[model samples]
Target: MPVIVAASALLFSSASLAHQLKSSVTTVLFNKRTHNIELMHRFYLHDTEHAIEHIVGKQADMLNSKSDQLQFADYVAQHVAIKTPESESIKLKNVGFEVDGKFFWVYQEAPMPAEPLSGLQMSHGALQELWPTQVNMVNIEGQGKVRTVYFDQQNQWHTVTF
Candidate 1:
């Protein structure tokens, strides 16, 4: 009876703690120079979107200004820590513009080839989709010029630039 209750309590506590340890936000940093996107998961144990929304909403209300939209951008950089896809630690030096309402991030280091000769590639077209706004040009470091195709909200692909 007592032992059973104690065991249940312990299990519940551990489960709660484990949930708290996992990251809530998956941050993808784009390096135009290296032509690689570094995906990171922030392990602050809370949902990143919720936090941003809450902070930004509060700030907007307080300021009563439309310009407060940029507050969320500032909050992310101040509170969020960069983590790798595997939940490893990473250091982000700068986080730049928020394109199409999503923040664009930059890292201190250029990406190195994980495998010896295999070329770097992204599994998905995340780079293009990361920023919802139209991109005019994409210049990758070391890799020279890269091509990009832009589509509108209607999914119509019209523009292509190198």
Candidate 2:
């Protein structure tokens, strides 16, 4: 009985260690003054490190290596998109990326459309391929209110209105 109990405890402990929270949050702000849509994505530092290593097929030093961070940022940029209701792409330019404490952030921005927009479609799949349980949430702030959209392994595109 003791042996069985010990084995069960070990199993549970191993499972707990293997499970990590796979999630990311992005804030999209429409700066009317600048006429730009700014995006800031926040992710777990540990997860980003592992993902960078897996994506580059080598050990990635995300904390100390700027190249690794840039590579990961590029990967993130390729997996994210913001489009208009008419399917016109909103060209998002990579602003930069940085690590702050236990989190890593990727920044992007695009010029706002000259015409008024009713809604925007967004897609985020940065780490979903590697970890199917990964969930990405985007909060868009504009016009004195905030709209939210979520993405996961199953659902890719979500539309939000300003």
lDDT on C-alpha atoms for all candidate structures: 0.36, 0.91
Q: Which lDDT tens digits does candidate 2 get at residues 90-161?
A: 999999999999889999999999898888998999999999999998998975678877899889998776
Worst 10 residues of 1 by lDDT: 118-127
Point out where model 2 deviates above 4 Å: 1-19
| Lowest lDDT 10-residue stretch of candidate 2 | 14-23
Q: Which stretches of candidate 1 lie over 4 Å from their true place?
A: 19-37, 42-46, 58-162
lDDT tens per residue, model 1, 1-162: 999999999999998876544222333435555655444422221232334445555423212323342453444344333333344444444434323223323223335335322122211122123234312222222333443322223333222211
Separately for all candidates shown, the number of backbone clashes (residues 3 or more apart, or on different chains) is 1, 0
Question: How high is the lDDT of residue 49 in model 2?
Answer: 92
Candidate 2: Cα lDDT at 107: 97
Question: At residue 108, what lDDT does model 1 achieve?
Answer: 31
Model 1: lDDT to the true structure? 0.36
